[model samples]
Target: MSQDQSSVSRRNFLTGTGAALAGTAAGLVGHSLFFRPSSAGAVKQGFEWPWPYTELDPEKVRKKGHAGYYDGDCAEGALYALVSELQENVGAPYTYLPVQIMGFGGGGVAGWCTLCGALNGACAAISLTSKDFYKLSSELVAWYCETPFPSHTSNELAKNGEFLVNKSNKVFKQTVSNSPLCHVSVCKWCKENECGSGCPDRSERCARMVGDVVAKTAEILNAYHFGEFRAQCSESDLAHSCQACHSKESPYEMGGWSRGKMDCTSCHIKGHASLVDPHHPGK
Candidate 1:
């Protein structure tokens, strides 16, 4: 009964128009990636690395995750559904994946809302299927930044469901997130939709995002398998202005706690820089 909506983000020149077109074409090709045969009876069972990308019904995948939301939360729901689908088709070793192990990834580990459970779940899937996990997962991380929330909505808007109705009493709409961290994503939603972190609507919105991630994971993985995939990291993926000062590659270290794929402001104050932005010293 989630509110229904369609979502699209502005395709920016921050990346290239050519790359966007290519990505669209690759996505349109629709899930024909080469699956390398797995080691254990993989040849016999006809399994492979880089599982073929399959076209997903966003609502179908959303419903799949939401049905299990109460039981396992976001990471478990999404990861289990995707892996289960592969196992059903590929059998054996594919089924050997420990799906429940992903539960810790949600809500920034136990509902605190850190790294997105969607990325956490999808990354686990990428690690299992691709040797190019970094490149593959990078695509996902970038996509999360570029995409809007609740990108797909349920078919029927159930009034009884946890739908966000703004002060105007209008159903809440989607917004693009420039950050990959769940904490930021939730905060933005709370501000724009006029909802609280603990609201049922907030939880539903994030849960619905899982469906988009799973669908996109299939798209990117499928493209990766077929050799059509390209890494699409945009300048937007970085807080490059701050990276020189805060990145792990920098001389300073924070024991890896103040580090990750997030936008810097997701956790830090932005007004002052500890170090100069070498690229733009005048600023």
Candidate 2:
């Protein structure tokens, strides 16, 4: 081939390759910018586990939780109340969170009547926002096991039409379940209120329960964010005695076979202690 012809061919090849490279680079830059998140926007940049959190008002969360119950029942309502607030406060990841994923947790995990749906939702939110999830979650559950459902504040809110949804204005008789199990909580409330579990009054009671639990969750999360969180709840006195012989920390040979901090009396009879020696922990 002639030198000029060969030189022109080489020049053309270089020009084509350079153009292709430039186009590729521009595409990459555009892609990065488009997909990169910003906390400044409705979705934030940080996508790490235990997402960022800021202080939230418990009263505001309480109202939202009640409304959310009407929207998606107990679990979804509790989670939506907390995460939706976070979406407004921190944007991004929290906003992107699909709270409906927790809908199955309603009525104690799809009505199987296991863990309380509100507690399940609160735990999910707590796990998302705090590394100390277990500790905080235990505190929340303990508080629930002792605190009466549909608190006076919640009843007043309903009476005054302050809740996002005013399903009932009647005051409910509050009862402590001493257990976090949904069946126990609901049955106790039902027995006290003298209503069927499927009754509107029961539903309203659960709605108020969602409000109370989510509000407490908000308060706990806010305290943690501000470094003011403290564990105000602990294992039940009955549980402490039972755990002395049956928990991971127990020194007995047969002890440490059991795990968890749930109230022992909830599932087991106090007669179990009599089976052991008089010197047993509770004895």
Candidate 3:
């Protein structure tokens, strides 16, 4: 009867209704262990950032720093920024969380270049949102295998590979060459020289290659995440393997390890060396 009592009752009713709706939606959608339903409706419906809305305190945001730019601390500033933008614009929640997790875990920097970061991010998001991680991952891999990225095409040249290259020539080619460092400028040069190590134009091409790789990587990721190719590669055994290997130590660091320590080179040798296994001390 009283104004305060009426307001409290109305709030309680809304809260209860929202919870019921979320539960029903989760069940209908098939739950994923990676994604937990939130009490917040809009946030739970994949329209905003995956973080809990109620937990988004200003102090916390500030402490976390820029929503979506690359931060050296986690190499996920850009991802966070993208998620924040999605939250502001489309209100999709948890859509990018899986990507953020994988990226931060060192998956983003791996040389596979087979899947763009955006595609990987989207896949991660799906994994998080699906009810069964294994099943969903498998489905995603199957989808991606059939619908290859533009770079994956064979006759196109400039755009026919898992990773795109940019040079004055605008030509694209895919090969099993090693990826250069993450520097944008260096990547440009490598792309121009076709990943050659001794060409005179190598330096210039390398610089541009760096920029091209970063830009292309960002572009592909965005497309895969938002475009119709959402089903590409439901379960990536390669990604899964990378995740497992990197969980111990990055290949970069392992490269310089002494014989006493684990040597990635021992297993993944290139050219002739790869044909012969370096004898393990015990074996």
Candidate 4:
């Protein structure tokens, strides 16, 4: 529950900290359908970082992580998806850290539902592998915002997963979630896709997105291990235009905060007009 300031790795202070998701039962459908997650599950006495890192197949991880989502939780799905692969390949810390610890990150801690739990899983991956977590996290987040997602399609669960949705008929209608917040991202996708933003489906969408995040994170870690990881997006790749007009740098600043290559409407709902309309000036 507490740690000394000198100790650096703050996986202890992460999103899913309690025993498991609250207000949920403790059985097969209790929450941790895969593994029983406790706040103390992943933590060991005098635990320290620079934890062992292994490179698993990114494409393989994409498949497994998505299936993990079907195990009934987003963060857990991503965690088991990638971590299990690492355990299969080269096992140690993977054996140590349980994927169940991430169960509370769906929406937000304890189902309060804020930041996308998929992103939380990615953060966990960063926390486990890299001391430069912020650098990797920042870049990963920017890419998430920029890319239209649930970017990949899913049909079958096997290694040679079948493609159900052809290029012609729509299956997953993708949307770019400018912010990492779960509700915003998933809701926007539903609206854009004309799916009407319902249950299981929205949950399904986030679950798939979890696959993308986890698999991409695997690629990042794999490349980092192989001397191929490069940070291509940062302060410059983020929102220079929006910041110029709305950030403190501008005389027209709206006391603006946060920076990224996201849509202008990701935040401003009413007080300000949206820059996203097709008829807008930029278009």
Candidate 5:
């Protein structure tokens, strides 16, 4: 072809490509605008701090929690079970929640063995739905420490093939950790059951524990929603006694060195000889 004819063809191709690109960009912009909510505030209100909550069935949540454990481990499972239920029942903001955000909490946060993942997930769910997050979360930790793991209800469900997922159908032994630490909880259970932490029996035990935690969380939320929630547990007498001298408000300067409501005996002995005596100087 002649040089002039070839140049004209090249120009035409460039023009057509530019037009197509412009059209595609415009279509994308329009698509986004079309899907935008008509009233941003209306939708935003649902996501306001401490999202709205409604009563949920403990049994239903328990089943979901058990199933979620198989898929996302403890933390994700616990949070997903509650938030997914809310997503179905209440819709909107609940639907927008990324339920897997707490997945890192599994095995006490990347296997560091800190707080139990089940409790971590349930606490996040509580924070999302309740204004009294701290109080309710404390109650949850206390209940976990004091209440036996693999509640009778969960064991019965497992035995009867009623749980959503049944990795193991054995009725496992139950034990109280007397502490919320994941390492403590798992080690105690493993020691009592005579099984390794990685064993299927332990996995089943954790799954059942997730169910119990989620069910209890649902119950607490339900009670609070109905204005019937009461503090079922509180700081142990030992904790209170230790805090009297060491808490933030302690009158003695040496007494105000530590704080928190967790059981003191869980990680510390009843008494320490190394502790400084406020009454005696340099003793």
Candidate 6:
């Protein structure tokens, strides 16, 4: 063949190959975007706990005063206690023999809002550690102590009278017995404004609701021994509080420790920057 012809032919072949490769790449990219695995509910599903119990030591937990239906290092102590009780009551393979307790710095604004610490802890524990949804559900119900709340209650548990009574007189009595005086004042005001004359005892009502929720949460934790509940509760509450507090301002908006406009990572990283340092400059 002529030299010019040979050169032309070689150029054509190279161009064709390059175009084919480019087409293949484009097709792959298109397929990935259009037919990628659907993760629409990933976050919702991810928030669920995966197991019946965590793996932590019961003896050590008790020694540390971490046993009971509401005793932990901080905000979710009730969750820790519940789990400890679960270990004692449930026993055996389900108890997470050598429990692995997770840590929480403290309960944030949510605790102040009167949310039950044990419920928060239980939510955290399930979301972060459990793999089996049924087991997680069972554990949650057990922690709470009353029958599983309606939506997920099974025929068996419910038939056995495990159904939670939304307005139990017994719970009301307990609440009245345990309510703080401050709560009583708030209840009185709420009653006078919301229910003119025949307001059911407000303080007792509030106490009952709070106690029922807390007691139920503790009951669920009683079926597991690991401290996953504490860890998750602490992290979840902090995450929620941080998000709420930082949403309104920008890092530079308000001065002084209030990096009002800063994103969570930016501020939290700074706060925990010295976590590992023995002689951190800030410390």
After superposition, the stretches of candidate 6 with alpha carbons farther than 4 Å from their true spots are: 1-75, 89-116, 132-211, 214-283
Candidate 6 global lDDT: 0.35
Least lDDT summed over 10 consecutive residues: which range in candidate 6?
A: 171-180
Residue-level lDDT of model 5, residues 166-219, one tens digit each, is 777788889999899999999999999999999989988999999999999999
Write model 3 residue lDDT over 96-179, tens digit each, in one string.
343355454222355333333333443443333332334433443344333312222222322332222222233433222222
Prediction 3 TM-score vs. true: 0.30
lDDT tens digits by residue: candidate 2, 73-189: 999999999999999989988878899999999999999999999999888999888867877888899899889888999999998989888888999999998999999999999
- Residue ranges of candidate 3 with Cα displaced over 4 Å: 1-102, 105-120, 142-169, 175-193, 196-283
Between candidates 2 and 5, the lDDT winner? 2
Top TM-score prediction, candidate number = 5
Model 6 RMSD, rounded to 1 decimal: 20.8
Per-residue CA lDDT of model 1 for 1-283, tens digit only, reads 0011112222322134435555433322222222323453344333444554444444455556555555577888778767877776666676666788998987867877777888888788887777678778888988888787766443133223532221122245677778877888888878888899898887767666776688788778767776499877663534765565555655654223234556665555533333434333323
Q: Which ten residues in a row have the lowest lDDT in candidate 5?
A: 27-36
- Residue runs of model 5 more than 4 Å from their true location after superposition: 1-46, 270-283
Ranked candidates, highest TM-score first: 5, 2, 4, 1, 3, 6
- Candidate 1 has a TM-score of 0.66
The local distance difference test score of model 5 is 0.83
- What is candidate 5's CA lDDT for residue 12? 47
Which residue pairs in candidate 5 have backbone atoms (N, alpha carbon, C) closer than 3 angstroms, thus clashing? Answer: 245-255, 246-255
What lDDT score is found at residue 238 in candidate 5?
79
Q: Of the pair 3 and 5, which is ahead by TM-score?
A: 5
Clashes of 2: 3
RMSD of 3: 15.7
True lDDT of residue 46, candidate 5: 31
